[model samples]
Target: MSEHTRIDCDIHNEVPDLEALYPYLPDHWLAYCRESAFNGPDAADYPESVPTTARDGSSPKPDLAEVQARVLDDVEIGILNCAYRVQSVRNEDLAASLATAVNQWQVEHWLEKETRLRASIVVPSHSPPLAAREIDRWGDHPGFVQVILPVRAEAPYGNRRYDPIYEAAIRHDLALGINYGGAPGHPPTPTGWPSYFIEDYAGMAQIFQSQVISLVCEGAFERFPSLRVALIEGGFTWLPSLMWRIDKEWKGLRHNTPYVRRRPSEYMRTHLRFTIQPLDAPPNPLHLAQILEQCGAEDLLLYASDYPHSHDSQDFLLDLLTADQREKIDSANARTFYRL
Candidate 1:
């Protein structure tokens, strides 16, 4: 790859409306939507009122040409992570149908049209069996590079019930992308629901931490050695402390989890990659450098614009990294992780 080439690991290509998916959905599901008068699942984690939902002067639903004019013109490749909120629906059957429809929509509307684009397979993650089947259904498509599940779920993703998802993903050589957003009907935080959207947004890193710990201690990495995970849109500033705490605690509790043979941090560094959008950098540039050094995350970070969502300037963090490290984070890491 050229040194100038860049790969964006996370980008959104939202479904404009239920009508857009009508062609992809089966007749049964089409009838269900019509008879129920269901418009679509309310999937946006960041409300439309929130400024972070879309950048200034950009269309909410950007067409391929707009995306090319804006984002693709700058990068060599971009992976589409459709935050369609298929996981939010309570009806498992309908959820599965929507997941299939979303994947087909990506195939026809996005992937087939752009060689520079790749997509993640959207799944009905609430139903592991259905999610696994969806992975199997589209796993072989060259345009899809990963399987995306929501960060919030009924149970932690590492639970035995999700083994089918892990198995199918590994079978397809697809990375498991746990992207931020999902309405599991549970409070976003460990406590009850927050009164403000700020509280909900700030608590996302905590949720991501819990999922990381769950995946490690539950031995998901041990059982499925080939499995790879990308934590998208969840900030990375908290990782150093999380890694230290988990590793320290694992030593005392190692007897409880005999399957987790190595230190938790080791498994995390080995199997996980994090997208660097919503970076959560501190006001001081040196602090960000220290955090990166503490976590030893040079190879683990991937480039992402999290297009359509606004975030604090990343120039400070980028300036802190060396040229080689910057290259890896810019595109090399993603290329290696996604097998592009």
Candidate 2:
């Protein structure tokens, strides 16, 4: 394959929260914001106060250009997909307004300003129609590469309620980029909330697995073959096990999910792509290459910094791969996955 560029599939650009979004809200909502007590946590990019979530190790650049200088100009990345997350607000209408506003803010503030940057269309998963409207409104923008929804949804994303979203994505050739963030109605865990942040942070893989199963079992892939889902900031080491177990179960339970039509792993390998942020790399170092081989991650894993939040400076995981595999993962697969 001809390779000419390197892509950073995931990078965060925080929108702060409701106060930062007030200017973009409708007049009626703006009035509500001014009067109502809007004391909320910073769900946009993890609260700065939370020591674990607070960006450490890497000195963060204050603006988009400075960020690009390290990953683009210095590192020579051809494109970077910016994900602005702000879906934490409980009120669906307020969240929808925030989603619309954030997308516009990203474009005006980031996408338009940075030539090498592209963005995900932030949407209100709490409200699918409004989400689809946001996608329709901004999906075609050259600066936007995909539509992003938080993985922590009230229900699995493959529910019929999200069909409209898949339809819009197919309509616009925009991939559904699932980033981990606020799902107001749903707790992160199956049995109520966790007491510790460690639990919330580590349980991310389990969350995405449910979403993966939901999409395939619900025949989302069957319904919209063109649709792609980028599992952003999600660890990729869980894939081999999940895919193996899913395929095995899918065999005996084929009747229940006849719409799936084939191995569950097949759909996933074809339709799903993941960013390598919180990658669970083996300690042996040499085993990193083996893990990639066994998990068949050469095409599935996309290079990303999960910038300002994660630090994997030494174990980028690209160095272990053959130059050919590195080339494909670095750019070609993302190009195919996002159609960029």
Candidate 3:
């Protein structure tokens, strides 16, 4: 690749521990936490901490400066959108406080120190009102560019309950970001929970598909025309298949979802954005190009390292594409999509 601008659209920042959040909590919650002997919730079961870190050039222990030197400076990222791993809480108020603490920690520790860092506002999974309040608090902060939710949400994200959340995003000119992480309300798989990590990994694409369908069929995009949903760590191959399937079904089943006036793909094209971390490298490299063309995703795609988490063979996934595509994926597309 030639000299080009790079912007990392997805990167993980682990909140060291719960004790770090105590200072940000209300007195009652603080007392409750101390009284309950709440050190922290057990670490969520995400599989990224396996051998893939060394395999993919991620630090086993990624602190702010370590990430800055190894991932950001190494790749020459002009901006890195930091997403936290702090969304596993069950209580609404406590969840909001934890999210706030993580953001505050980032603001004081990372954003204030690093010039190239920007982040998503992590919100409580089950509470839209509280989530919206978090957005309202930090939406104006230059360091926070979007509101981040997990695609593995308590419900399909576009349900009416989440309208207030999206409304807050629109009201604040912040994009809504959805990453991977399932909640308990839904089965990990369509049939049942996965027993192994591979099974869980296999279902991630389906999770993304279900989310896009929910957003389109439920008219989330229509209701908030300016609203944009960034699918961080959401891979690309399944998108074409979903677009075709939904548009085909919508033609015959429009009455069931009259709010979706246009073809499903049309709305997705206008409203959704996806990160390219674990890029869909097919057996035949040329076939990858076909997938991009089939899905009409040249502009919709954003480049992400998924730093210290997903291990891409190469830092960027546009090596197979033409030079122009490489340039756009590197920085231009992210600039427009995130309104940076």
Candidate 4:
């Protein structure tokens, strides 16, 4: 691939509304949604009014033309992650149906229309059996490169209940993308619900950290050696500290989890990749470079614009990286990971 070729690993393709999915949904679910007056799943994470949810002047539900102008023009390839909040639905059957609809909707509306685009297979992650079934349905589709699960779940993704989802993903050779959203009917933080959105938003790094710990210590990587996970939208600045802490604990406590055969940080570095959106950069660009070196994250980071969701400029971060490191983050890493 050309050094200049950029593969945006994260971008949103909004599902306009319930009506838009009506064509793809089954008759039973279509009637149920219409009669029950369901306005579709609620926004589980980002509030609609916030400027961060939709950048100034960017469309909340961008059409193909808007995406080409705003996103595709800037990159060689863009992977679409539809944050439809299907996991927020309490009814298991309905949630599964909605997930299927979302995947099909992406196929007809976006992936087919734009060859430059690829999408994540949305799943009803609350129910792993159904989620695995959804993954199996479209896992072979060339247009889809990963299985998207919300970062927030009823249990850590490494729990036994989620094994079927992982197995199916590995069988299909698809990466697992844990995007930042989902309402699992629990508080966003370990301390319980916060009064303000800022508190919840800031606490997301903790959630990602817990999931990483769970995946590593629980031996998900050991069980499925082929599994690859992408931590999307969650910031990457907290990684170095988490790696140090986990490695330290694993050294003395490895007896408790015999399945974890190697150091936690080793498994993390091998199996996980993080998108560099919402980058929590320090005041000095040199500090950010040092953090990347501490974590040995040159091959672990992937480029993402997180289109339609605003974030601070990343030119400083880009400027600090070596030409080779920047090329890997820009496109090479994603190309190899997504098998594009």
Candidate 5:
């Protein structure tokens, strides 16, 4: 395969300035800023939230050119730039408005700025009704492939309140992505401490687990046969165990949820695809071979850099897959999932 064929599935586009997109919000809303200083209780004499001043003392700015060179161009990646402000806006109405505005701005400023970049519709989970409307409004954007959701709320993703949003995803032929955030009002954990931001970040995988389980068992998959779902930011290793547990429970409780027509594992292979980043080192090419052997090789795992947030390089990951596997993970899989 040509180097340009490689598709880095996961990349983060930072939102340091919301003014152009969020013209409706006052200066104060755009002004509240913080910087990650390695300080505080978990701080290494650095502040976790330090606001950076522009040379003239303005809002934090995203270094787009650097991002393009370091991540997109270098990896030869076709990027999926997930939006940021969706999770931060808590109010249902405000959240919906912000999501629409951000997506529109993304088309005009970000994605259109780069041929390789793509984006998603950031829906407001706080209000499924308005979210559904917003999804209907822009679900058909050729650049939009998934519904970006931050899995920070305590409510089960299977709750009926979210049905409209899911329905919208199915209607638009878009994938539903569950990402994580540091938003307040979210449940801390079964063992609560509210300790540190990193601690909360660690809990992201579990939140995905809960959402996936709730959706599958609750028959959301069966209901929306055409809808595809992706779990981004969260690593893929957790999937094997989660799929196993879902299967074990299904054998015992199959009668309770008759709507589910296939084994949980089957559902995963058909409707699910995951972004692979923060991957554990493969013992060798053989270990990587074994992983693809077990999981559905084509259209199963995707390549992502989590760019700017991490090194955003694919050299290590690319070295793991064989020629055939590399072709699948790099391009075919993403093209199939996003219908590119």
Candidate 6:
């Protein structure tokens, strides 16, 4: 395979043996795991039958060799790796134990095995103290890149409860990643319960937009000057409209957030970077370019395939890049954003 310039900033590398790292977790959490299957009820009934990680609809334990061969050897993705917690993050204890366990697992297993991979450390979002400790513990590891949390937390990210986590991110120069999780955990929609995964997943972009707005309007960026944020998945297209709306509304609501010294769009361009993956279909290059231009973030945009998810893969993205913007999308952007 020929060497490539592109550095894939987003990839979904799953864990196939998270249990082997279970010893690092606290005993009480292990007991809970023994009772409930984190994945599903079928795995709950037969713990032995449960595979530690499942990939994109392949074997319960996907062949790692196959993934590397496809992404590296075939497609030439220079750095194909996970940027968030692969396992043991769903627990509610907000303990550093799970975060440490997952980081150790990535180092001992994935990073040790491949030179072209990096990972994010997962922290308990509900417990700032423990989360800060975990950031202090693993932020220096060469294999670790960012601090990741699901966007479904009950409190808006800019809430004071997350100040410590943001502080740790600034202290360690680690980027903060917000990935989609579940419900807003607030009120029900007009349709009541979602009937399908599509129904729930379709709303992911809206939720992400809310968090970004909440953080920006609530002065998170102002409070943490050095902190960086990346909205994972292809939800970034929502940013332009959200930022515009926030700016328009800020005129009438400036007093509501007196601490925010700048407009929402200003903060977004200064501190935020976004990943492009599983791009919305019927690709509109002009529309995409317009968004990039309006946000003043063409350089901060990063390339990601969300591999094994079908819609995003090396081939798909390679095809999506235009003749003129290919280099910027495929490599230069990620290299600049990640400081690679």
Which stretches of candidate 2 lie above 4 Å from their native place?
1-5, 39-45, 51-62, 75-86, 314-316
What is residue 190's positional error in candidate 1, in angstroms?
1.2
| Candidate 1 wrongly placed segments (more than 4 Å) | 1-3
Off by over 4 Å in 5: 1-4, 24-61, 74-77, 83-85, 182-184, 281-289, 311-317
| CA lDDT for candidate 6 | 0.63
- Model 4 worst lDDT run, 10 consecutive residues: 43-52
Candidate 2 TM-score, true structure as reference: 0.91
Per-candidate TM equals 0.98, 0.91, 0.92, 0.98, 0.82, 0.81
**lDDT tens per residue, model 6, 108-142:** 76678877777777776667778888888987777
Instruction: For candidate 2, give the lDDT of residue 121.
Output: 83
1-340 per-residue lDDT for model 3 (tens digits): 4577688887777666677777787788888888888765443435446654333555644678778776676454433344444455676688788788778887887788887888788777578888888888888998888888767776887798998888888888888778766454557667877787766665777888889999999988778888898887768878888898999999999999888889999998888888887775676766877888988777888878777775556443566767788888778888887778
- After superposition, the stretches of candidate 4 with alpha carbons farther than 4 Å from their true spots are 1-3
Go through the candidates in order and give the clash count of each: 0, 0, 0, 0, 11, 0
Full ranking by TM-score: 4, 1, 3, 2, 5, 6
TM-score of 6: 0.81
Q: Quantify how close model 5 is to the true structure by its C-alpha RMSD in Å.
A: 6.0
Query: Which should have the higher lDDT, number 3 or number 4?
Result: 4
Scored against the true structure, residue 148 in model 3 reaches a CA lDDT of: 80
Best lDDT among the predictions, by candidate number = 4
Every candidate's lDDT = 0.89, 0.75, 0.75, 0.90, 0.66, 0.63
> What lDDT score is found at residue 47 in candidate 5?
23
Tens digits of lDDT, candidate 5, 193-241: 5577566656667777787887788787788787688777766666777
True-vs-predicted CA distance for residue 51, candidate 2, Å: 4.9
